[model samples]
Target: MQLSVLDQSVAVTGRTEDASIRETLTLARHCEALGYRRFWVSEHHSHPTIVGSAPEVLMAAIAATTSRIRVGSAGVMLPHYAALKVAEQFRVLEAIAPGRIDLGVGRAPGSDMRTARLLSSDPRQSADNFPIQVRELQAWLAGVDLPEGHPGRGVTANPMGPSAPEMWMLGSSDYGAQLAAHYGLPYAFAYFITDGQGAGQALDLYRANYRPSPRHPAPQAVLCVWALAADTEAEAWHHFSGRERWKIDRNRGALAALPSPEEVALRPYTPAEQMEADKLRANAFVGSGPQVAAKLRALANTLEVEELVVITWAHDPAARRRSYELLAREFF
Candidate 1:
């Protein structure tokens, strides 16, 4: 199995949010050294917990700093921006790193409707035109002629080079799967987003309906999963305490930065909250390196995917790095 990374530049308590961005860059370089396949960042706008609002900018930085690992967005929210502009931005990135860019696009608004409206040229613009946008974005990225009667028939996204960014359709639902299948693009299911719900169905739909393209003759699928690993199972669970508390609090409308595990240990959970926490813990991939790696292998095999993009969060950036290091030791 090929293990990749999806770093969201998570903000931790008592640290500046900008620090999270820097940490993401540092982690990308670290992952590259550890022999990971790709280092993908996420796009989330006006989000308190997730600060990676600009994935294209961050991808450029990562592409400049890392020589081998593939760099991409997981992904750029298509409805928020013009396809031509996104194509141009990624074209510039391809110019920077050549064959290492992956342009993952999605239909969902990465933020609240107010922020989505602010991001759009038309405040009323919804995701209804996502398919059209993806078609145009793909054409522009590859410097192909737009179809007849298209508004961008003659325009080209320039600095067109020897290579173009590989496109991947990303989602937590079947909509992205079907769209990706229709376009013959790679599909990545956000297993971490829905905590594995609907993942099997989405992947099955993608493979069953896939239309072969020149770039991809066969269906390609990826799972973006959340996992953490440490020296021991107990230690791993301790490190996961912060994310667990954050998840529960997030459900209760508290979007605070990740608290330290030490701080989490002191808080008391109600019976219902404790049950919820237990459910999350049971579902989580937290343990020693071998234990977590075993689960990762099982999940990849069960999902019938060769690539698993691991995304980990911890109050301490060191712990996050260690998590990746441990997994790399097992898988790489």
Candidate 2:
């Protein structure tokens, strides 16, 4: 079982008015040393909670710092960027990192509708054009032939990779499945979101309708689970509790310093709030090493995914690193 580790570089702090931007590049080295398979960052805009606004830029930094582990964006919101530009940007990164880049693409803005509109107001070519955008990116990456002397011909694309970045379809819906099959690309489902559908049902749909392409014939699947681990189940929950508060507050439109896991479990919640937390966070894995391992194992058992991708965050840097280390020891 490959334990794929990834982070979104959320704001982590206990007291600062604003979460300082901690350099996760150094942390990526630790992740590599700890034997994580990948270190992926996510892109978000105008959010107080996350600091990963430019994931490709961050991935390049991490790639330069570490020689082995795969690095990439959990996904770049494709609708807001040009396929040609993204192809060029990643091709350049691939030139540096070579075999280490993984390009996960998504259609989400990672923000609300107002922000989404502000990011890309072009009505003619925006979110609704996801399929076209993906196809364009695929063509650009594969270096598909263009009309003679076409401007698109000079894109200098490389579809396959040692240095070439592998492409992944990321989504919370069946929409991603269709695109992955159509492009014959590997698909990574956000278990964080699809828990509403049950992993088996979505995984079943993805596998059954998959089309074999030169890039992927086996219908590769990845499941994303939130994880936190510690020495003892109690200690793990203790550590995870604070982070849960971070989530709870974020969901409730309240924002402040990141919470320690211990803070979450030790704190009291109203009955309504506790139920809300449970419903909102049913997909997350928060416990001691063994406890987290069991939760992850059950998710894998149910999803039967090809890879288990852990998507987690912390408010405190030390706690964050320890959490990942504990998870690696038990689950990886």
Candidate 3:
């Protein structure tokens, strides 16, 4: 099916529980043992909900622990940082993990407008420059000579850096699709971010306008989705019940610890919250091995996605770990 499973690092925790960095490292190492194709750490600045704000730092830890699995950002919100610096850091990571590193960049600053403005002071950078940054980073990794007027010409990256980690354009919108087409790198669509809109139009735009380059002749696509599997459908849904409630509360300016499955079930919820929860879970695939496999397969055909990255959030860390293990056993 040309399908590969993927997971996001959320630092799984209970309502009042804390997930230690040590525990996260262990979880990631366990995934490597479980044989996932790639483990992607998302980038978010100063979020109490997630522990992976610095993807490179976490990559260093993960790279040290595993040998076969590819590790990189599901996206490292590129607009927030310098391309050369990102290139250098990933080059170092590539030095350690070699062919196993992947770089997926997103245009979003990953926060509210106020916070985005604080992080990305320049108002001029929109989706237009994302392609340029990806190209610039690729050149930096390839050791291609920079343009004479380019400010980064003076800086040098690692001599031992592996062939630049495979680059990917990530987005939930058409702008990212166009950028991916222009650059000819693999493109990933976050179905989780799209809120149930059909990505077909955007994917069509990407394939139609795709320009072939030596680096990538065929366009590659990944559908990023929220998924979970346990011994039973009820257990899987219950396992994810806390994160589900957490998401329901996140919009109300509440970032409190996630409630446990039992607590969320017992707790009262507004009608509005219930509606949103239904929509979120509508995209979420939670069930047993056979059921999850069937849902994922159908999603793959419906999206025509070359790869499937299962980005999950579960209430319990152990349950989250088991989810990966289950996927590995069924699909890997």
Per-residue C-alpha lDDT of model 1 across residues 184-291, encoded as one tens digit per residue: 999999999999999999999999999999999999999999999998899899999999999999999989888999899799899989999999998999999999
- What TM-score, over all chains together, does every model reach? 0.99, 0.88, 0.90
Better of 1 and 2 by lDDT: 1
Between candidates 1 and 3, the lDDT winner? 1
Worst 10 residues of 3 by lDDT: 11-20
TM-score of 1: 0.99
Computed on alpha carbons, the lDDT of every model, listed in order, comes to 0.94, 0.75, 0.76
Cα-lDDT of candidate 2: 0.75
**lDDT at 297, model 1:** 98
Per-prediction count of colliding residue pairs? 0, 12, 1
lDDT measured at residue 300 in model 3 versus the true structure, 0 to 100: 84
lDDT of 2 by residue, 187-207 (tens): 888876554465566667788
Superposed Cα deviation of residue 70, candidate 3 (Å):
0.6
